[model samples]
Target: MNDLEHVKPAAAPKKPARRRFLLSGAGLAGALLVGWGVTPPRQRLMAQAPLPVQDGAVALNGWVAIAPDNTVSVVVPRAEMGQGVSTALPMLVAEELDVPLASVRILQAPIDKIYANVAVMRENLPFHPDDTGNTRAVTQWALAKVARELGINLTGGSSSVKDLWLPMREAGATARGLLIAAASSTWQVPPGQVRTQDGHLFHDASGRKASYGSFAAAAAQATPVEVPLKAPHAFRLIGHAAPRRDSRIKVDGSARFGIDARPEGMVYAALRMSPTIGGTIAGVSPVPVLAMPGVLSVIDFSGALEGQTGAQAGVAVVAHTFWQARQAAAALSIRWDEGPHAALSTATLFEQMAAALDGDDEHVYHSRGDIAAAHEGAKVIRAEYRAPLLAHAAMEPVNCTAQVSGGKVRLWLSTQVPTIAVDIAAKVAGVAVADVELHEHLIGGGFGRRLEVDMVAQAVAIALQCQGRPVQVIWSREDDIMHDVYRPAALARLEGTLDGTGTIRSWSSRGASGALGHQFVRRNLGLPAAGPDKTTVEGGYDMQYAIAHQRIAHSAIDSAVPLGNWRSVGHSQNAFFKESFVDELAHAAGKDPVALRRDMLAGHPRQLAVLDAAVRRAGSAPPGRAHGVALHQSYGSIVAQVAEVSVEGGEIRVHRVVCAIDCGIAVNPNLVAQQMESSVIFGLSAALAGEITVTGGKIDQGNFGDYPVLRMPQAPRVETVISLSSEPPEGVGEPGVPPVAPAVANAVFKLTGQRLRSLPLRLS
Candidate 1:
């Protein structure tokens, strides 16, 4: 494979110089004093329990804190699941705050209402033009309903920084404005006369200066104003590559992941859940586990919250050590009610979905122009695609530490939804949500798996049963793999017609998938069924391609298997189906995939721009390499990926991948590049080697040994080309995922002359 490190830079001109700012010591002191003084003593006291003010710093949520010593602390709301949000998010806040990257310290934000993400709420609205419901009116109603139900918009749908981009920067800018206000007041000068730079506030003409620390207390009293954000040309720290704030801590093993947490008097708990989905505990005997070494107690826990299927439900063995708990839990004898899903099998699920696809029951997600006439007047090509159920396989598995005392419960866990964790823990522990204090620790990885609060509830239950002792509930790799909220298996049938001139005439896609709404309804509303799931219809309804005559419909089939969001949610599977079918249509029209896509996307300048750049960077036609290109829009970003592949000894070898992304304005180019690479690897792994097969309602794969992730040796060389634009920053975490699988699969088709429709593209 050719080394990408040696690739020459493209002919694009060098970027313009960015605006620069540095906070002086006086500015820092002024900001700190204002922050301290404005924050009431009562509020400070309320923030004290389980909320630690780091040495030399005053706390503000988990992300932003000002220290008496002139340092800034930034709390990261989302876990660093290797997607680079940890670094990118802080850059957005620090850029407008006028603090140097080095002066800012990143802290994991605690799970609370204040820190909940708002983007998920917006995405949940049924406002798309395709829906039959009064799209505008229903959207407004749904938005209000989502806000009322969720309490706080929580993270998911790759909307961490994108959701917070404007708000968080506005927060920083608001704080800066207040600091300047405070400094001006302290100096007895007009606010307009005071200029803030770095950590210091200065009256340049008067030569008077004060550190932000000195003004912080006073600034905290000033009501935040609606200041206009800085223009793109004024961005300094945002566009540039700053060293990752968590790099040093992660490299030094000082980062506290869920597994690293150990509270005082902590005991370990291990559970043996039923082998089937929706199973419940029927009977349990503690006598078998009590005599085991280090076993403290064995208790039956059947009080799980509704709608959390696949969670372990049975007796838990609590002990001094995790190993002891595991041993005792394994040795304990228990009886389970396998529930109604005992007869479930993967084959049965596929059959049920196929039946749904053939049935008259369907929801029209999108429709445009005259699809019937277009199809009747042209040559048509059709194909069906299938994607299997998948597990999140987060590196840390599922674990949480909880201590319940009296009416209060304290929790430490690596959770994407900390507020939800607290709520569920409070419910399980029989306390108010406010009484549950959650310490959001660094996650080993989340990937949408931690969004569920089952583990948190389990920990609370175990802790409550342990009297006042803290109990850490740990899920082994086996437990995590066997019992997880899986990504839904889907079947998509596509029909595309081309005119005699090779112009596309009609496009139609029919899909059957497990309901994502069911999980939401079960968790949020306590209802067993909402209407048909909207998530199952996302990518099809939101297709960015300019196909004039098109229809996308979905059949929401009930599955015995439990399903929830994976990394890219619905797009992970839908992108493969849509793009691969597009490639097939391109081939049928006797056109190059790139050229065909460009022709179809005549009005989508941003999408076409990324597609053209990625193809150029990949060397449109390389020697001994077949290239496949796919462009997709998800999470408000357009990404185009070109994969170069070669088949050797019946194994598909991916040599390199060139990715071009137009995520509007990149906060940190290096971080964007890194996340793209990470997303590519993650998506590629799922395409070539990921699947969770089941038999008799039990997962066939147990650990990494059976369900393998992509190893370093199999990883391809990744090259990312970013487009510079002045538009608002879109999502970076999941946009890269949608294009990878289709790109690679199309390349494999080019090499073999045979289309591989399924995931884990096996050689037959």
Candidate 2:
């Protein structure tokens, strides 16, 4: 028996011929009670039971709810944040269900148990050498079970669609099977005698048929079946381009983003806080803003200093409107305690990290062969590279709305992690997780910033203190910039030994960076240290190339500056460091950059395929339009980028970029291409202009004026070559991000004959 055989049908069966006729008459009576039954109070107080699927519909995880109308409601757990996942992920389900693409509707997923991505559990691996056998298998099993029961969905690590590819399709196919079974039983025929197309079920021999809506009630009572999914060759919509589901809405300003959510009886809140991150309000003087027009209340929020994980303390100005709140907040004055981060600065932090790299203390993440012997016998080349702090400058500033009433909480936010937001809100409201209901909204942009639900916590705290009134907390552009959990600065030193045959004999890399795992370790696992910072050592250590002798070590430098994952996590910085250094080595060996990478990666076909494709697309260009190549495999996809750039008047201008990616089976070729384009633009901005600097523990940049993003006029022409393969779709969002930076920098090097070692490439 297949997996579906295990699912028993509902105990109550429909009364065959008379059920539909009776239901039609009963619908008039039930219509009056529908609003009452589905009210917030009723839905919230309802016993926590398995979600009941309507007849002819199926629950594919909690996020996806398919209806008898042939409408597929894709519960998007991840914030759309302009990543196009809303369009791409639904295609995966629609392909297997064999439904018309136009019938699907995208829904922002609610906080539930079935929405969590299980791949993030990999972060729990032990980093120390002695802790090799760190209960990974057991932990994964436990997490999987918890995820199934709780539906704790996450939207980071570029694993959204790839993670749900199988389970989601299975859900759709299973639902289709049940519909066939139900129709067969109703017609007194074998299941094989019934056929389904679009939203209709037919019994050919009987010359009778009904729409799925008509049989929905009967289908809901039938036992589920494990139906086999169609092969890629059989897919009509999976790899094809359909207009993005959100395009019309977004274009016409009909997309209901987080900023667009306006709840009834909602009061807007603007925060006034210390410039220094982690600082707290020592005292608040409300006299300055008490008389301000539209100012309702001045609440002192001391919760930021309560040692809560990822908390921010501030004074909230509640007002009638967002503009009023902002005015009140601007007029209010408060004394601040700058906390332990008072002395922190961007320069000093980088110095501290650089100092750690020179020390003997280090963790060897991965190593092989004899590095010492290879380094001693061959011609060695070394280079040091650096990337400064960065921020996720999402188009929509951080905002969340919370309504706390009678020990129950409801929140609306643009968040990547709804489960975490619900938990935080529950903790803040002194309620259970089940008591907190989250309505996720479309993110203006996530990039990784929405992964933390701090804004949700702030909204909940304010709402809870307002005597059950709904509060909408809005973060100004300054609040977003000054208080952002920045992408940490990193310093990498690469040493490569090349033999007479132009082959790299040994590769040794050491990096020093703020530990990303530290926050998780300190808060969740209660560990003192986060061990080796994988983000610091990952690129060179986990190099896909077939290097004979290699050793990659990391020196974890603790810093007060808040750090979190950026677009491509460590690979964004590491790709620049590793790929740029590889190009340097190629030039030193008097070999082509493409040829050098191909030679080093002879054993890896996937890596070679992408690299070769990028190179072929680039051609053998020289001088004015110099070609630069870089390859990186992260989040399961191997991507190679070839950048063509021209340096004029000491300014680097990128003309075009050729990207070759092998992300398994392209679920939607159009979506993959769109993601690649988005990633390149995002990466280009970070490579050429992105930086989050600090002075006296305060971020120096605010909004797009100072912290600029890539504009359409400046965007380079991007072409994507997707490797057609039968392998499962790996990742698309972040994998495209890592290669663009290094490719551009390497191109700049060829154009000017100056190695641009650092990010935000400056020409002097």
Candidate 3:
């Protein structure tokens, strides 16, 4: 059996509920504030409970376990969403433990405070990258503490490796130290005399050797001695292209995704959601559906759960099989209350945002020098850009299997936030959090979709009516597309001025969009996050270009579209708006686009190097193709891309994309390259044809035919160049996504002489 199929028969040690944890945190708030200056960050090296050791295996701290045969198991708390985290993260441990990578086994982690995603939360702070003042520092410190206390195990923001870099390595080193100490004691020698390599301890002087398994029991009793992490030069697994551990299993079809989950006496449920956003089921006609063959029951799924704003409450048809349930669901008639957003439409949303942009409700997120003074007597250029709401469109449709029996709940699903999932399950099932057990599966594709628990809540709600039997709730492709928490539609108005020396003296960008972070906190954490939202103006406000007078503002417009984080969050669209406008500035100044960007990036060497690398690697486009370049930084990584494009049969054909990234150090250079290629294709799909429109508060597109992704024939040849850097790993998953759209859009301008300011780049 695969390691993913293994689960401890005994119940894991209980952890505090999220609500109770928050209440306790509130109680300690006063003391924390008093000792704010001296309190250290929470230690992540140890778990709150012991590791779930298998038979004949010994626990070695919270992260690793050693078995009788010297097999090692490393617990990875983050979701493996085809990002190679399942491979890259274990390399961190294997490198420090001085073991061959193949000897380590991957295990899904249970709920633990030590696995909280503090790095991604810190990245969400509304401070500019250049802002290193006390306010930024203090806010980050407090936020990190809050994140640790909350302990929401999230897997997005490309933060899995970055967050676990130190903790995982330290865990390995700590285990290695304990084993060496145990071996040295047995040999009657000094601790330094026993060296560890390849899962074995050696006392070379005495010629005594033993496997780590031999010292496992002794190591558990030994007091842990602090061990130093391996320097980069000594690393054997990291910084190399280690094969993805999941590749073989996935290739051979043994990898289990959420949809593949099977439980004894399992039933299938087909959900028929409300047609409109925020709508609820008024009544379900069960006459014919109840009489249908294999049909179990028609369940009323009405009312939204807490923090599940904009999620549709509908009816579920339960049956013996998915096919039966789907047929019954389609045959049933359900009345819906369309709610207040019945008249909402995409055009109206744009109108509302445009009005907000012109109004006085905007907050200036970043301001440098005097924009008015710098614009005086300078050549002014102005433009507007728009990006439509987008769907995550992950390969696997949303699904979850829930078993509510004997006053306990068991959940099997693919989720990016297991902690949040457990909370939602407990609350919905009316059970103590400890009574809820979650079996997280490998996500076919997350791309930020599984980060929400609305689907989990919906599944559990349907399962409750199954009368103690397990029900696997599956969403049809149409259901998944219509009910998706979509990426926010955004619009930006930009202005720039060129001086007599052809230098950009002033830059001002005003963006309008639903505040994703604020909405996310409301929907995910059940808290209203007020004040400035960093995600609303990230790529625009945090540009690396060294403009003297720069002002970036954002107006948080209210909409019923139900905003959620997409692949790159705000940077996905903001980069296109900011970089396209920069290209406009370059064209107006009669300078090469790359050259103008290079001049402005004089102060940012890493960004400049990445930009130059893409340009140089691209060299020149093939005959009849033009090249366009863009640079963007997000999640502590800098990425630049050059798109080669041409117009054929009235369609924009991108023949190639040359990408360069400085994501600090690529833990797995092969994964880095794969991510770059994936990002380019994903972003290209959005730029070329991806859009989610709404009419009368209803989602317009339901399946891929209408909302198409980039097919293989349309996928551009992607050449990824990784910069050799000594900096700590940043993010490869999302940083590469922010640059591809702008690069392709700018390239289309060179090829067609038409500036496409909107997404799905249509020819006029």
Each candidate's TM vs. the true structure? 0.89, 0.89, 0.96
**Which scores greater on TM-score, model 1 or model 3?**
3
Deviation in angstroms for 99 in model 3? 0.9
For 98-134, candidate 2 gives per-residue lDDT tens digits of 6677877776554444555655543333232223364
Per-residue C-alpha lDDT of model 1 across residues 217-284, encoded as one tens digit per residue: 67767654345679999988888887776788889989888888889999999988888777877766
lDDT of each: 0.76, 0.74, 0.85
TM-score of model number 1: 0.89
Candidate 3 residue lDDT tens string, 1-764: 43212211112123244463231211223333455535788888788888878868998888989997999999989999899988999999998888888999988897888999988766666678877799778767776776677687999988989989999999999999889878877888988888888999999998999999888999988976667998888878889998899999999999999999999999999988889887865665677778999998877655424334334667788899999999999998777789889999999999999999889999998899999998778767999999999999999999999998897999999999998888878877777888899998999899999988887887777777788899999999998888898889998999999987788889999989998776777777665466787778888898878899999999998767888889998999999998898999999989999999989888889999999998999997888999989999988999999999999988889899999999987899999999999899889889999999999989999999999999999998999999999899998898888888888889889988899999978988
All candidates: CA RMSD (Å):
12.3, 12.2, 5.5
For candidate 3, the TM-score is 0.96
- The 10 consecutive residues of candidate 2 with the worst lDDT sum are 17-26
What C-alpha lDDT, on a 0 to 100 scale, does residue 4 get in candidate 3?
14
Candidate order, lDDT descending: 3, 1, 2
Residue 625 of model 1 has an lDDT of 71
Candidate 3 error regions (>4 Å): 1-37, 304-310
Supply every candidate's count of residue pairs whose N, Cα or C atoms clash at under 3 angstroms. Answer: 52, 7, 0
The 10-residue segment with the lowest total lDDT in model 1: 19-28
